[model samples]
Target chain A: MSDNPQNKVKIEARDVQVFYGEAQALHGIDLDLNANEVTALIGPSGCGKSTFLRCINRMNDVIDGCRVAGTITIDGQDVYSPEIDVVELRARVGMVFQKPNPFPKSIYDNVAYGPRIHGLAQSREQLDHIVESSLKRAGLWAEVRDRLSASGTSLSGGQQQRLCIARAIAVSPDVVLMDEPCSALDPIATAVIEELMEELRKDYTIVIVTHSMQQAARISQRTAYFHLGNVVEHGATQQIFTNPKNQQTEAYISGKIG
Target chain B: MTEPSNPSARKAQLAKRYRAERRFRAYGIAAISTAGLILFFLMGSILLSSLPAFTQHYVTLDIDITERHVDTQDLANSDWRALARNALRAQFPEVSGRKEKRALGKLLSIGSSDDVRDYVTANPSSLGTSIRLPLTLSDDIDLLLKGVIDRDLPENERVVSNQDLAWLDRLLDEDRISRQFATRIFTNGDSREPELAGLRGALVGSLWTLLVTLLASFPLGVMAAIYLEEIAPKNRLTQIIEVNINNLAAVPSIVFGLLGLAVFINFFGMPRSAPLVGGLVLALMTLPRIIIPTRAAFAAIPPSIREAAMGVGASRLQVIMHHVLPLAMPGILTGTIIGLAQAAGETAPLLMIGMMAFIVDLPTDVTAKATVLPAQIYMWANNPERAFMARTSAGIVVLLSLLLMVNATAIYFRKRFEKRW
Candidate 1:
């Protein structure tokens, strides 16, 4: 709605409906995520924001009896098309979970897992370089540089989450999806991740589903408020938080209803 | 309901809870001790009864294998029993009747002929000279020496006659009759005489059978479990298959034996009483056992680990091979080894496959006619001879030890490789 020519749509979703078995979870969602910017989706618990985030990389396909019906495109390619290889699609679109889920392996191997599986490096030195740069980008290189041989789970909570981020970006995906990456961290750790997100938006398109509105307003350029599986408000983050057009969005933002 | 804001009421409630906890602990201790007592009695009786089988009586004789009696050119055809009988007659010069001489010959085991032949064949130079050698005693005399057959029993009630007893007493006084460890129980194969019966044949048979069962069931069970747990969709067909697998585990083991007899022996023309057929039967019996636990092991793995791998662009097969398998390996191995242990102790199914036959020669390969440990124990237990009772108990001890070893290996693998997420 801003009519800015410089904002390019990196992923576009139209009328996306999701169903788990016989129970419908999301109904007809429409949203656009722009290139080199962060889009924040804020909703109450069980409001389908995480489900929508999982749709971009086809993560929902792995769940038994879970179906997503709609056209979701990344750079004009339909992700649900018959010819689309889900492995390649996921390689181009990475995801991080709510908890810090690093493989029970050495820290270097955890970050190199993606690159190795995707064949992104030609030699061990190239893989080492990829792991180093990814960790550096996630701001975890300084804390874990000397302990790459240690298990990823042996790290502190915030550091482990950053290691997961480094792992997600090691294959150099164009889009990164984060589902409440800071929910399990303390305020200081959350702040570190929020700062990392602001820096990550310079190179990768990011979509985050957060429960905290303040987290959305602090790091995201675009904001969408979801209620009962519907997008109630969508616009520039400043405009959506300050001057929302919808009464439900205002009620949620003002703590009147969730 | 007893808790209250008042301090005295809260204190009473806490005391009651503590008392209940202590009572529960007492019950647990009592249950464990009862189990321990039962195990102690069971093992004590088996060990006590088996002790007599460990030692055997041998009658040593100074016999001359003369050149005339033993044709050195025809060692295999030489009448070694006649030479032993002649030496025994030489011992009792005053007793000269044919029946008395036959009774005197009965003191030594029939197998002593084979032993003399074997010695003479090995040491040809000692044929003409007199050599002292230990000869195996007959089972009845062996039992008498071991106090299994009561020496005080009346003449008709006991298998050992007065004349035989007199000869045994004289030999004992002369230090010619001796009791030593029964090395033959470990070295020889099955025989009608209890003194000559050993577990070597049955032990080898069990080894071959378990090898076949492991090779047949483990991979098949694991592959089936992986398919059912990870890949197969939850539908009517898979649900039916799951129910059938559970039912298969509950089917009487004898039914699997019958199936093996019919399908493998009758239809496929596999050898009857072969370890190969017995192993195939046991494999069928243990398959559902392995699959159930393998599936449970797979189910215990957190789905998050799988999703994490998938998020990094791993294919479904790669996710299982790289992450899920390593995490579940300890559980899988424990389940498989426990299944094998159960199969090792199984007897009814092997009986249906004719493994209860009286096998004498050690099975050289899987397809040879053979019997397992439990089958051998069963055969010995069914024999009416008093000497067989101790052998039966000894066979049970050996079987129990092997089972213990297998179960211990299962526990060792579980503790050595178990991983925490």
Candidate 2:
């Protein structure tokens, strides 16, 4: 694991501005996400945290009036370049949404969806191995191994969330973006996911958008505090929690305001 | 009651609430019963009126063809009708007047001559012999046998003249007349004579028209819906297209008939009364019907599903084909059944397309002259003959039963693969 503060940059955003029709949502923003590190984007609602996460994999393209201006590069290729196919970019940078949205299929098929679409596995045995390893990595294999044929929707909320994680990682993506991945789960389930994120960053560059300050402080290596479409402060997680340079970050930590 | 301070007020409130509930329940039951009774009366009336069309009576007569009547040198050019009439006249020698003989000949169906010719052709060696053959009785005679002519009415009041009535009674007493299941009504096509008509032509025409409609409309409608709902950018042009499609659904169906006439028949030079052309017209009408529901089906899917598929690197087309389309298929099929059923019963469009032509031949292909079931019913309803009225009711029975079957199949599909998730 790259525990050093100076890890190679995996994704770099420069003068990033987003607009929905005529209304600008993000004013020129710059951020660099490091490799094999968990970078948590913590902000209040409608503060452009989720929008920034979406820009990495070009998911904002699906929105009707959404437009992103600036250079956002992954592996030194601008994601918004004319030659960049959004499909392949998304294949490289997978996402886990806030709510667990599993395909209406069996548990085994749910995990196999990514590998099957990407054609990453060559044979049935290879696919089975990938599914097993992905589920094991998501900390769900032992509990669901016997019920692989059961519907993914039939699982409990925590299990379904982990299954989404397993589905995202099944394609062997280099980066994973999670938007409040544990927002819909109980505290116990949140702790379990937080622990899984610690293990996930051993291979994947992870960016998480979270409302929970404690979750960000506990799981992420670096934390950025956002307020009103701007990054108010960013540093090591412990430094941001103990020694805040921004008044909004201090007020948010003290529960004076969101 | 013991614990409450306002016990009387609470009791009165409960009683009023119960009364209101009872009144609501009574209203529901009354409405259901009223609808049920109306349906029962309609079915009973159709059944009572159509019973005769399901059965037919025929006479077993012996006819002789001699060398003078049929030339051996030209067996192909034969007059079986003249021979049948002579043999029948010779059987009843008491009929001396020419008028009485003509009435006796009227007792036989106009198609009876074809029956005789067919019999002669099938058995060539027995051409000169007196062969006993069963020939279709005239519509009046058949109605008389069914007891619809009302024998108790004075002879002048009834359709059958007294002279032929006595002959019919005599034939009945001699056991020369007998009833059989109405195989002819199901086997033959539309006829001026009800006894010679059948549902085969209408059934085949309906099937062919619907096959073409389904083949043409389903994919087109589904693709249009996918493009509009899934892929198209929301702009003024797309908005206009949406409005036009919805407006097309509300436009009176007969307008489509005129459009089809102008575009398909006049401009394209397609044949009238051919199921191929009729189907093309019906397909154009059915496209909006299908697209509306297909779009609704796709709309019902939560956006999360599409995002999930796209998140896995599935292209937009792949996401729709693999995930969205599969989930929406049952609803799409339900809509298709409704569209096809409507096309099955559509008469006005076909009427405008000239599918109302009196077609007696069963179509072997889509281009052959054909009349759909509703058009057949419309033609039968317009006939002056009482026999055709009964056949019209029978045709209604067939059409309703087909609609019921389509609805049942739709329900089966709904129950089979409805994705609960």
Candidate 3:
């Protein structure tokens, strides 16, 4: 693939190893995430794709007996350094989940929670503006604009997933990590999320871990194929899919192996 | 496994399975109805036994409050009993002997003087005027009037003797005998006389004790539960603590009473029979009960909510306070109220802490020596007096009503705030 000025590294991860108790889940993974681009990690179950995505925002810290050892940096600053405040780090690098988890609160409050906690808005009008723009960017404003006071859970599955997206971007984070954000959604809902991601990539760095190879092919500029806790191939999405690659990557894309 | 090759055999097997299912359903109905029947019988008996205690027999007489008997300056020390005795003697002029006169005097309660005093105190202008005052009947005469003593029994077997019966009949014929609501049972405090014994002291003590229990246990229990569920690491120490908590919930309540007696009373020198000490002991007993269910309520919340909050840059405390705690609140409140209800009905620990004492005054504060409802009921049940039997049942009814109200509040809150995740 030809290089462009837009392809600047936003996140640099090197020799990242993850473990649950004594069982290692990821073995020395190296990946570079570009600014303003969607990077998709595609692999079978237990392939360490989701684990690697969580390394960016330190979401795994809450889990017991889970540990990560390596260097993960955003804009050349180490995320795992003792100086990094987790709360602030998370605000800088937000995350969306596999299932739609909206707080049992009004749609407006759900979207405004991020900004309120981080003191991003000085006035109610500014907070409202953030909620509106975030919802619009996620393509849910038209459906939910009139009923922002209604509970976010009252929406349909697809709309709820969109609401979660809006909530994540409400804080204006630099990077958004989504872990199989479409797994619990239907295909139509999944397509809406994919399109939303495509639009989101223009402003924020996006990293998604998905089981769907087609989703990786359609939405991502760079794709990494993982198997058995190891990355088998990493390149431009088109080359990884269409051109010759490693034997394992070939077998996986051909549906002969996972 | 042998496969049924014929449709008829398969149909027969299906019929057999249906019959088994019907039998199982019948067994379930039988079990539930059995429980319902027992509960109905228990409540019915308590209500029936308490019915007579709700009303009392009083004899109204026109007694002249002369200026000579009542010292206008010192009404508190006035000889009001003399007035009641003279009024009774005037009603029965035919009886002249001392033995017969003493027997007639037993018809009125010993506290009848207080009744006259209270009336005179309220109506100071009525001095030197004839006012009709209703005097409380003694417990024996009351039981006789209510037909609980069986008047037809032989003179020796009956509590109301022949002379007492004649005077009571004379009073009844003259329209002096009136059955009124037993307001004294709720108005006055505990007494040696069953008719004068009231539940006010016990009620106040129970309220104070439960207030302390709730204030002491609820926040502590909830915080301990949160720490164990969300903050504590899963290791041998926590595992031991969890196991002990479960074991504490099953320990005999008397053990908690002994601990209170030793620690709060003997070591700390806290007042015995005080609601504060009783409440603290009960709080200790109820802590495990509250914590166990609270932990369960918290555990029932989905992990996704916590993750959602943390993903949005919420701190650990923020994740629990904003998302997990609200979702788990209904369960926590229900557990806490149920534990409190159990604590309200608990008697063993209180008895051990000296709350079974015969307290005559309403507890003024948590530190005052007082007796709770269950302790009062236990003491009344042990009394040999016949009227005390009815009082015990009445006390049980009050305690049961309180428990029902608390449980209803639990249900109401659970229904009101519960959210489907």
Candidate 4:
């Protein structure tokens, strides 16, 4: 892998802390995600890896009594400032969840929802192109082209997940976050999602939280290992897996401890 | 593992479990049959009492219209009162005294001469002809025919005098009186005459009132539910509102009647007996009925849907408007229909707002004076007329049918969308 200095930082988080009521979930953390790169966060259960991923898109703001204290910037623009419109920020940064949840409407409507709300496509032909290309990029167009009017929930678990990915990218967001996107899928379906992620990294910056170490090694350019609300190691995937600096990272890779 | 090794004990345990299941099934069947039996009893009683109201008895009479009975120059303006009394007297030649003649007149309906006048106006050329007309029998004779007033009772306590009862018996023996199915009960509107009263006014008023209730409550209730359950912060204010909604559903419906009398009739200056005012008042009462269940339905949806929509860059409001609403639609519609059924049967509120009026014509518009089914039935039940008893029962029958139709529609939507979504 080439370490190019020309690669601009897409997201920067410094000393990030998250709390739910009186209980703190995430300790102070510093990490930078590069453009056109896939960064994977991996840890055991209750390690706050998913919580950190949620902070990037501000999805946790909907929860009552939950607070986040940190400076999170996207392309040097402050994401937490009062001047920032949360709705527009969300349109710029999209997400995919672990369970495949498609709207109870037609597949075309599911993909067109974001674009229609934001007035992204001026004409029907433009919206048609956006939907088709988004599905094609997600590796679901060829299978679903004949039945574009079918309900998205009618598809299989894997197809629904891909449809969600297509739905997320329909508005052309610069950053996409996935929270254990393949955890609910079978091994074969997991393989298909991993393959799709490989192609998506060329255009949009992706941040994924996964429990499977093999998935982190297979697709990510950079990996961060979390242990009990703290990130213990961060570097290239190859270097971290083969020759890590911390004993916890080494023991985690060797299966001595979670 | 040790328990399975003991075969005798295991067999006994299985037998006991199967026996318990059988007992539970029997209890369920017993409960359902009890409910069905009560419903059958209620419907059967109402039908029995209401059937007689749709038929009436008539007596045929013949009388020669003399020159004095008709003003031939302006024949169309002639009244039937003098002719009808002469016709009754001509049938019974022995009645000569004034008091006895008046008692004889009581055997015929107060509305009988009006019927004779209709016939004369239709055929005005035969002014001096002798016509045999079937006239409506009065309530005394009607009760006598139905055996409701006992002939064995002393004349002083009965609805008819001894001579009048004997005359009615003679008319029955001669086969001059006949029973015919009453059509005016279906064609005419509310009236002081019980035999001519109909349910058309109340039926149409309920139709319009329900339309207004649906228009004002459905969208407003569903939207309010969405806001409270999905968007509004769960703080003390919302909690207080939630508790009050629950209390509203349980509050004496008369409280809403008072509210309507205060807000809609007095404060708003709306027409007192108009369906428009009645509908607005019912909508206020029905709002809480629908909103509580709608919020429960929204709450029943899995949280994964909200999470999924949010993940796709949808705002909180968008998540509810686009995703949550479509899924919970069938439940919301069913709740709205149940609330409407409750509103259709609401009497106290309507009575408070002056819907208890004797309306003789179908209300042509929302602003016109109107009466609802329950209020109309209540008025008829309180009337002293024996004929109105059957009419009141018939109104109940019609009201039940309307409620059934609305509930059936709710079932249709429930079946259509419950599983599809």
The DockQ of each candidate is: 0.69, 0.71, 0.81, 0.51
Q: What is candidate 2's lDDT per residue for B1-421, written digit by digit as tens?
A: 5444697977888898899999999999999999999999999999889889999888888888676777666665667677778766866889988888898888888777777887777778886688887777899889988988887889878888887878878888889898888887788888888878889999999999999899999999999998999999999999999999999888887888899899988999998888988998899889999999999999999898998988889998889988999999998999988988988889888888888879888999989999999999988999988899899999999999999999999889878878866
Please say which candidate is ahead in DockQ: 2 or 3.
3
Residues B1-421, candidate 3, lDDT per residue (tens digit)?
5659898998998899999999999999999999999999999999999988899999998898987788889988998988888888888888898888888888999888989999999988889888898999999999999989999999999878887888889899999999999998888889999999999999999999999999999999999999999999999999999999999999999999999999999999999999999999999999999999899999998888888898889999898888888888999999999999999999999889999999999999999989999999999999999999999999999899989999999999999999875
Clashes of each: 0, 1, 0, 0
Candidate 1 per-residue C-alpha lDDT over A1-258 given as tens digits, one digit per residue, 9 for 90 to 100: 332458799999999999999988889999998998899999788889999999999999978899999899999999999999999998899999998889888999999999998888999999999999999999999999999999998999999999999999998999999999999999999999999998998889999999898998888899998888889889898898899999989989888887
Query: For residues A4-112, what per-residue lDDT tens digits would candidate 3 score against the true structure?
Result: 4568999999999999999999999988889988888988889999999998999989888999998999999999999999999999888999999999899999999
What RMSD, rounded to one decimal, does every model reach?
2.4, 3.1, 1.4, 3.6
Instruction: Order the numbered candidates by lDDT, best leading.
Output: 3, 1, 2, 4
The pairs that clash in candidate 1 are: none
Fnat score for model 2: 0.66
* Candidate 4, position B258, lDDT: 85
Segments of candidate 1 deviating more than 4 angstroms: A1-5, B4-17, B69-77, B87-90, B121-125
Clashes of 4: 0
The number of clashing residue pairs in model 2 is 1
Best by TM-score: 3
User: Which candidate leads the pack in DockQ?
Assistant: 3
Mark the regions of model 2 whose C-alpha exceeds 4 Å error after superposition: A1-3, B1-14, B62-78, B82-93, B113-133
Per-residue error (Å), model 3, residue B47: 0.9
Candidate 1 per-residue lDDT over residues B1-421, each given as its tens digit: 5459899989998999999999999999999999999999999999999989999888788889888889877898888998887777777788888898889999988878877898888898897999888888899999898888999999999999998999989889888988889988888889999888999999999999999999999999999999999999989999999999999999999999999999999999999999999999999988999999999999999887888888889899989999898888988999999999999899999988899989899999999999999999999999988889999999999999999988899899999988665
After the best TM-score superposition of candidate 4, give how far the Cα of residue B105 lies from its true spot, in angstroms: 4.2
